[model samples]
Target chain A: MSATESPASTPLLAVNNIEVIYDHVILVLKGVSLAVPEGGIVALLGANGAGKTTTLKAVSNLLGAERGDVTKGAIHFRGERVDQLTPAELVRRGVVQVMEGRHCFAHLSIEENLLTGAYTQALSRSELRDALERVYHYFPRLKERRASQAGYTSGGEQQMCAIGRAIMARPAMILLDEPSMGLAPQIVEQIFEIVKDLNVRERISFLLAEQNTMVALRYADFGYILENGRVVMEGSAQALGSNEDVKEFYLGLASEGRKSFRDARSYRRRKRWLA
Target chain B: MELIFFFEVLVGGLLAGIMYSLVALGFVLIYKASGVFNFAQGAMVFFAALAFVSFQSWGWPFPLALLAALATMIVVALATERVVLRKLVNQPPITLFMATIGLTFVLEGLAQLIFGTDVHRLELGIPDDPLEIQGMLISTFDLIAAGVAALLVVALGVFFQYTRVGRALRAVADDHQAALSIGIPLQHIWAIVWAVAGFVALVAGLLWGARLGVQFALTLVALKALPVLILGGFTSVPGAIVGGLIIGASEKLAEVYVGPFVGGGIENWFAYVLALGFLLVRPEGLFGERHIDRV
Candidate 1:
């Protein structure tokens, strides 16, 4: 089914042509839209300042906190119009976001940081313990350093903690932003493996905003490429991964071979999709 | 004999320091959760005390009066969150601080307008009689107040460390945007913190009212908490306690030991002087989190 027609199936989350403006003047997102199917991983691929984070924040209803407002369009989660709901209300409805840069509570222990995710759940003691064990099962490194302050943990561990913390919320969907940012390639691959595992086992959907296009396209079921606050191109992961333009512009691969810095700088000005 | 006298002064100062911690605790709660240095905390103390006394004067029973006053503080907290803070989300911290300074005046004015300016003596049935222990005298009222403060500190400590809501509060304190994205309701957390701060204000109000009478001057006691916050770190509960104790003991000791040479009344300014010196040495305070930027 086409992206437009998929909304009739009531996908997990649907962002319909939303426009976001910050400070009521600076327009950040213009007529951007995407959908994450239930139990599917969708990648929001873009360079920096391409409105990937803004789109995720729009779906999570977190833009308001940063003086950004959705000036137009609607966001539906599980067929309910949730554009106006508070972020906590959205979480209660099983939508949580792992913000970029591993925003772990520095002073709190890893366990405490995870527990904060379950704040709205009101789980019993045993249930809470079960949730922690479940998260630890996926990220054993977190289990080993559960008592340590999150600030002192390594970059990869903090990323795991951020995702683990979201898992503790028992969310139906998680808006994962920049999970691969600043992490080594091996660590990024490991995180994607756990994310795929969680998707398969727990049936959790993910709308991931990632600048690491090559790795994200490898794992995501579908992908949308955003540029200058607009979706320029979108397709199944296989299609986007193999597309020549995507390989040239994003992965630095050309018809001949890997492009040098001079050729790559000129490649952006020759984006056929923008034309 | 001299040693015995010094111990008495030290003990007295320590107990009085607990009172300062009580008021400072309210400031810490609001500051930690919202990053707003609530200048209105002093006014909240005065307002709660005045409300309690006013309710009692209306022929309500003591427990009933206390409950009503507690409810009033909760209302004040909710209103403040809804009206003032809800409008100022994402504003700079200085803007919020300035708003609270405006709030302080409004609360003080409202308290006077509602409860009248009359100074009413609050009798909590705790006698002010001195109890002697090995030739050193201690006030029974001070002992009971210190005990109450200790109980409060323990209860607050448990609430913060052991509860789900407590974890959310700390998370929000660390980062607002992240907390919100994770579905920790920023508004609810702010309201809860303010309500808890209001509750702390009530306890402090009642105790200070009984000791010094419920009057306009009771608002000035919040100034004493300033030195306590400076010493303990504005974000740490134990810091408030230790800060208060040091400020209390040294000030009293300074008044007694150094008063003859300096012509007395050094007790009032000694805490500030010490806090200033402390600021130069450790600006973050003893328990305040040291901010380290990783570049």
Candidate 2:
């Protein structure tokens, strides 16, 4: 893992002090910043409505579709500013996003869904087949259910198909939002393992938003915790996982003896980071 | 002799249904891509046919006039995507539908202003004279028009199934945000779909104009597509064809067999009644995809 990490040079992607507003009125993200090193797996940890998804969408320029705009600061990919680029332009520059809730093309078959991901690439027939083979190599389950409709597939398979579709784009960096949403624990493990394999083997970088702090820190090299559209805490994964505040608040590991409901309620109100 | 006459009406009505299918095809193409029920399709048909005739009156040949009319429709399509739809992205479906309604009036008024409201005769050179086949009479023009519609449907099917743009179109139809995230330019896709829909409108316009003089009434022919769409499903290409045939054949058959008792002119309302009944039972139509949400 250390060999894969470069020494504080230009990171693969950098989100610097950015703010997001939706519908030209409601503010969603406020002065959040983070970075993903080359060939690294970085996690954005936050509860629902914490702006993790917004940050990822801001990087991919998908915020525009939802009437959200990155109004402040800038995003840089490989030392070049890219916050103004369209989503398709961003994809052409090798950044793709797998949306939350596995937005698979429901009417299409699994293989067709995967093929749609390669729309930006103009590959020959043999090259297209080779790309499909590469994706299937990473996700053998996708191969087994290639003929089935994506909507009919299990949650885990749909999630895999979503990731497999992203892989078909051959992206340098992927913005993954909540890969473990509504899936079994074992399935989450399997997916994280595949994500790790892709990171190491394909040298692809990941900026994943996750609510599962313990599971995310177990796999991610670095993590950032967001609260109410703000980056409240960020650190190395080990430091965050072992930190007393994170362990107590995010991981549900209170250092004191077992407490009543009132004590737990008061404990949340007294978040140390906010203080 | 009675049986032979019956076969003639059946075949003629079926061919006429193909014309309705042509108009419905335009609606389906735009709806599938952008989820907009384009009410302006009728006006487009009127506009294209009028443009073609007006161009021909200025001494352009048949092929040149046709090309010029097609170009006009393409321009209209591109302009609509840019001026109207681009600004309305992610809007509710009803809002888009209302916008198309506004577009209908704009197209109708603009076409009349440019081409004048006087009805013009359009002759495609396909003679409407009856031809005897297997001891039954059929109009050659209807036969030719049906053949053209069949060819267009086949070409569209191949385009949607085999091309990258077609795959991207389906993806866009399924989910716009997801399609964008995967790098499919929503604007480009919208422009392409509207252009294709425009092309379809042009073809329908030319054929219908040739059948029933290039007049403002040509726009009413799009109303005939409404029944076809209700019976065939709004999203399926094949559904349009099949629904058109059923509506066509059944209405003619009802006019011949059931009209005398009802004092005639049942043909216009027969399709609507059938469509209404179909809505009660199989609202999705034969090939329309039924959305099954897993709670």
Question: Which pairs clash in model 1?
Answer: B232-B239
Worst 10 residues of 1 chain B by lDDT: B286-295
Question: What TM-score does the predicted chain A of each candidate obtain versus native chain A?
Answer: 0.95, 0.94
lDDT of 2 at A30: 81
Q: Identify the CAPRI category of the predicted complex in candidate 1.
A: medium
Q: Measured with DockQ on alpha carbons, how good is candidate 1?
A: 0.78
How would you encode candidate 1's per-residue C-alpha lDDT over A129-221 as one tens digit per residue? Answer: 999999999999999999999888899999999999999889999999999999999999999999999999999999999999999999999
Candidate 2 lDDT tens digits, A135-209: 999999999999999989999999999999988888999999999999999999999999999999999999999
Docking outcome class, model 2 = high
Interface DockQ per candidate = 0.78, 0.82
User: Candidate 2: which stretches are off by over 4 Å?
Assistant: A1-7, A272-275
TM-score of each: 0.97, 0.97
Q: Could you tell me how far off, in angstroms, the CA of residue A54 lies in candidate 1 after the best superposition?
A: 0.5
Let me know the DockQ for model 2: 0.82
